[model samples]
Target: MYLRTLYKYKKWLFWLVTIVIVIQGIIFLKQGAVATPFFNYGMYSEKIPYLDNYPVYKIYANGKLLQGNDFSIQGWDRIYVPLLKFEGKDTVNAEMIDIRNRLLYKLRLGSLDRKNAHFENPDFDDQDFYSWYRQYLSCVTGVSVNDLLIVKQDYQWNGSRLLPGDSLVIWPTIP
Candidate 1:
């Protein structure tokens, strides 16, 4: 009787295990590829294997490099890169720009102002981001917020290494 029951439900068990494995595999692949598409499941376009084609943003204030823990460029590399590429000149990118601009204006970093494929400011703009960044800078560097000269520099990555690239002036303070 037990053997018969097991055999009867074996197909259901097999399907359940298969579904779980597929979901786990998708997650693992997504992590490895950043914002990658799976059978066009999570993305509109086919997944590309170039993981290192992302850009890295570096922040410097008062001629001193800021700590990466305080602000991360992962969001740009993970979320924005894929969207910008797939959506092109769609409303999604515009909305993202607007959100970024609002944050920049609040942080007094100036607007990110984009022109064509280039960003005029490239400087990040987020309020909660600013709150923590300001506090972190104050505590870590003991530098007054007004005296810091903040700037953002972007580097292109080629799956393995980063190359020299664009620089944006975020905060200009006289020395």
Candidate 2:
């Protein structure tokens, strides 16, 4: 009787797992690569060449400009995600910058792309990604979400180092 019950439930378990995987795949497709970090099944990604130059932009939170330490998420968010996002992009003409800045810039650029329906029309505060970005800002800024205001500004490279680019807000009001 127990063996028969196990055999009967095995099919259900398999179906349940299959359904979960299908759901995950659907979400992954809709949300761009950021939504899911599943194992890559193809070898095409490995064939891509490395980029020496990448863009970097200034970020501010709550009117206070953020430093590199704030944006830095040791491994996953800072490095790996950018690598994944820029795998096939045109990088040859990009101005060469430090590796860390390159990755951070790519991650921010990926956030700007409106790939998911949820992230589209970003002015509405109730969206999942809006909330997520606010939460991320809170973490990076050490400020409560209620009081936080985020901005991205342009930074010009003046020969040896980056200088404020026009002192203009590039991303004025999160959208």
Candidate 3:
């Protein structure tokens, strides 16, 4: 029964297999190129580099330290992902500018003008990010956040355990 069905769709199957093979060949030849639908496995073929230190944001809401162990994976993500994104806003802006310039150049619209270009960053510039973050945290944690403290701590792995090093309070600083 299966063989009869396979035989019936043999022509369609042949074309489908041929198209996939062609796409795979193109992806292989392109090397590091990002081809969606048919991905280049070369992207994951390289070994990830080892890092000596890892920076983590320790968030305290209303004098209580929020531990990842106490929350679900998604809950922890909601707590820290915005902080990571907000911290790298400048880097994101720079990449966005580069992308815009490349797109303009590709479409024969000339390069981006540093002084005159009206390019605005897609991410909203929140001068008082901590204030907003405090409110956001309140909503996420289901508690009123009167005080918020974000400590950027660098941790080093010493084979056995992670040792906390130099800490800096990044939020709620005195003027």
Q: Point to the candidate with the largest TM-score.
A: 3
Model 3, C-alpha of 75: deviation from truth (Å): 1.2
**Which parts of model 1 are misplaced by more than 4 Å?**
1-11, 21-58, 67-128, 137-147, 154-166, 172-175
User: Compared with the true structure, what per-residue lDDT tens digits does model 1 show for residues 1-175?
Assistant: 5445654789777666666658768776765332233332455455776543344434455556656454457733442343233323342366666666776778887634543245322343343334445555565455655444445455666666777677665444334
Off by over 4 Å in 2: 1-57, 70-128, 139-143, 167-175
Candidate scoring better on lDDT of 2 and 3 = 3
Q: What would you estimate as the lDDT of candidate 1? A: 0.51
Residue 152 local lDDT, model 3:
89
Error in Å for residue 99 of model 1: 18
Instruction: Return the clash pairs for model 3, or none.
Output: none
C-alpha-based local distance difference test score of model 3: 0.78
Better of 2 and 3 by TM-score: 3
lDDT of 3 by residue, 1-175 (tens): 5545654779677667677779888888877444578876565568977578889989999899999988899998999899998876752466667766776779877644453245553445544677788899999999999988888899998888899999998886757
For model 3, where is the 10-residue window of minimal lDDT? 114-123
Candidate 2: C-alpha lDDT: 0.47
Q: What residue pairs clash in candidate 1, if any at all?
A: 52-159, 104-125
